[model samples]
Target: MNSKHQILVIGAGTGGLMMASRLKKEHKDFDIAIIDPAKTHYYQPAWTLVGAGTYDFEDTAKPMADLIPKGVKWYQDKVTAMDPDSNSVSTEKSGEIKYDYLVVSPGLTYDMSLVPGLSEAIDKGNVCSNYTDPKHTLEVLKNFKGGTALFTQPTTPIKCGGAPQKIMYLAEAYFKKHGLKDKTNVVFATNGTVIFAVPEIKETLMKIVDRKNINLKFYHALKRIDAEKQIAWYELAPEAYEHNPAKLEIEKEGNMVGIHYDMLHLAPPSVAPEFVRKSKLANAEGWLDVDHHSLQHNKYPNVFGLGDVAALPTAKTGAAIRKQVPVVLDNIEKLMKNQAADNKKYNGYSSCPLVTEYGKMVLAEFDYDNKFTPDPELKKMLIFDSSKEHWRLWILKKYGLPYLYWNKMLKGQDV
Candidate 1:
């Protein structure tokens, strides 16, 4: 059967769901349809706490049918093809859906198979990843008694940059609480030279690393894992000039190294899904090609995208999506009216509450320019430093944010 909508959302994830709810509320007559493969909706930001054993995995997920806005059509199927030129998307189960405007937020694809032996190691024993399914987090944490615990962040861009290190800090605190801090050697091995991209936040993080005695390794990319030997292999980044496309530069930096570990937490490489990557609307790097400020497709006027899958040069987080939803909704609405889209710009605002320990967090808020944009009331209302880990902020991340996401953000009610 032929289906058409004023706005077609390709995914029912945070970005798509938020935009659809907003559009439906703003204009009831505007037809909006959301397509997602799964019937469940997840609060992904809470996964970090789940990995730390602070939250139950079940609490972080919800029934999609309950959260999706009433009146908007929901198609429970995966997007098989995106035909932006014809303003239509084909789903695996449902047939073609035509649209006047399209909002693509399918999210990134986690490539767990990229790292050799990683799949086996993660499936075999005390290994976990907070980025994927949260159900297994508790089981993995329960087995961690002692020994060298390794946490890794890949070179590829991930949804939440701070999540890998956030779990590491939680693991450190968990060990202390369990009276096993002395027995466990916690290490953070990442491809980045610094702990975080923001200088202010990085300063605080470095101090935490020093105080906690957490081993930090830079320029180290996880190459493989050995579950039996409990050895995690890493390859150093090649020197700047050594990156000659003509030659194989695998060992230009040095020989691959290994770190023995009893438990491992990994953040895998992520990319746009193959369907979006092969579509005409996507960039060469396989992400939805949209203008950084406008959130509109560079080539296709009818297409727009946001969230982790969009080619926006900012931190890919739900916090960024909060700021982006309004921009995407407004621009698409303007296009639907046969008017030129307004020039409402996005400042690349994104936030990451760097939970260094159980009670402490370095609130890292910045934009595309890497300039800090702190909340004005945070500076005025609070006597204590907002950057420091406070019980108030912890409650905000743990309890307050989830409520805001479901009841407010998903309902088109903005704070």
Candidate 2:
């Protein structure tokens, strides 16, 4: 009910929740309030396995009420408009709230409707996307039998770039397990020219694709889906125009082609929310305009952001948020004390446990410069191999991660 607070955190997702919980633990004087419309908190990383039938959907989600940090004010309302200059944000249910400091981490929006016939295909069976709601995952997987199953990644920046292919790999493993490998054809259709960003990882992925006999289609963008005919239309690059062959040249540039598919797994385009997108604080790419080092708003000093919505030029994942939480908290604490904070920079450290199969994963850890930051210490401490396809990594992903996320990361307990 109070409209004023020392700090207002928009969204109760990983970033927002982490920031609020950390701030509450560090500074008792500051009144912290969190606004979110959702009633559940999902460990989104687990959805890949859920789609693959490896993990139960129920295990990936938890009640929002139980997750909110103790003593912090919780407002279950959607943010309608955010006015950075006035230090106020309006909500759908609760009119307006004013704050001394604001943290925007509402997360990105998944625009599935942008793809033609995608909605119908998903409803009609034969198409599923693990990047969205988990309820439909089981239905889609159950219907998949023996046919050309296509997995696609959009050109736009996504929350977890590796996630699209992770599910594909899982499906490939599932087909093999169920004795349908020979009958079914698996394909990864991506706009990117390479499988993985890191050269080391890409090399491994290429071997896996070849060994498994999975078709890899690059520079092909998903155009439309004909669910009825089970035909997915894709425009290949280097498309030539008949009217002006010499003057116009090739539009697609040797990359124009089309392919039909029996089944499709679509990854929708993602972007910052309209409120954040339209705001001046957003970058040209429509992400929170923040210093990559400070995680503070480039324009508004009192505002800060992290996680998927931030304009940090790195893969958006919860692992990135784990490293960012402390930096943001320290900076905010120092600012509140009217003291200059030490420039503790974040090197865009993000991890993607690339699950190549049900029991295998390539723990890809890298920073902003695309350099490996392997946790050899973790391997030594746990007494396990850090290589791809280890049961230890699988257990870490299945049980260890969710526990760490809830008890440590969200609670602001530094490990």
Candidate 3:
């Protein structure tokens, strides 16, 4: 095997695979290689549906072997260290690899330790998370005995910001189906003040929150969980703490409070992978330090990043990866040819299909400024109003996006 290559991709997840495939389609003869130890590549967007028991868990995964682009050498090994200054990467199995350009997209790591007792609580049936295991989530929903079901969002950045609530909405629908709606006390506890960032979708979700009679606890972040005792602990946000204490009840240990629950669904705290987090390449927030517009490293011109790992101020989602792919590829091509780069710039575009109910979704698409930027293809054709809940968007979320991911994006079609 060659020690040096024209391009080296660090992770074979959505971003790396898409970038490699696109590069392959454009430059068939380019010396490209991808390093990853994963045997299976998962279509993570469908996990929500899987958790809701609407989609099969098996359908969300594919062998990594089947997805790698033709002629792109695959190193099935985990990366240990990156020496960008020496233009080389060190892997566990393959000692050293040199590259003219590097692409880092290992994605985030789940920090189960962020919330005390989270690791031990997840296996206890009553506490399940859709973020990690969709099957467990289904099991939890099926075995629900009906009481106060608590859905929580952590304070840290998470992939698919709408996911914490998406499953809750699905659980609500499930309760209605099984005649448990009356007995179920549905509560959504999140640290964020608003239900959603986009105004149009937030307005729509507010209506759903009211109509469904779901409890909305704003400025409440999950602090810990006593799974054995069926107690979920929370700490009030700074704003809430600063507000009049006359109305709010404070616990003896400061602003802590507890909610008794029959079932607890939590969104685990997410952070950059340990390898990336400990590296000098990472920013203050422990994410890849890259220019938001060009997708290039702020310090090193040869380094590029995208997807969940990059410090781009956008909601991390597969839809966001689709938008980031083109910009990274364009810049890489220019840099490879020794031409002045920066022609293509990413606009911080990300889309989150907020599944409000069964067969209904509000496709929230936006840019850096949090302004609604609907897909031009759908917007021009007037297929559906993305900001409103529609069955068409739900179909796209269920069927269309997965098809596009496997057949188009990873195959280098760029659409």
**Winning model by TM-score:** 3
Lowest-sum lDDT 10-residue window in model 2 = 241-250
Tell me the tens digit of each residue's lDDT in model 1 across 294-393.
8889998878888999998889999999999998878876786788776567989998978877876777889998887777756543525655666667
Order the candidate numbers by lDDT, best to worst: 3, 1, 2
Q: Pick the lDDT winner.
A: 3
Could you list the CA RMSD of all candidates, in the order they appear? 4.7, 5.0, 2.8
lDDT of 3 by residue, 263-298 (tens): 888889999988888887899999999999888999
Candidate 3, residue 331: the lDDT equals 88
Q: If scored against the real structure, what TM-score would every candidate get?
A: 0.93, 0.92, 0.95
Tally clashing residue pairs in candidate 2.
11
Better of 1 and 2 by TM-score: 1
Q: Compared with the true structure, what per-residue lDDT tens digits does model 2 show for residues 1-415?
A: 4399988998899998888888888777679999999999999999888888778888888999998988899999988888898899888888889998888899999776666777777644667788775457657667667777778877778988899888888888888888888877787777777787777777777777877778776767777666776766666655322210111111232344445566678777788998888887788888999989888898898888989999998999999998888888888888888976455688899988888877877777888987767777566546244534566778788888888998998887884
Q: Which stretches of model 2 miss by more than 4 angstroms?
A: 238-256, 341-344, 381-387
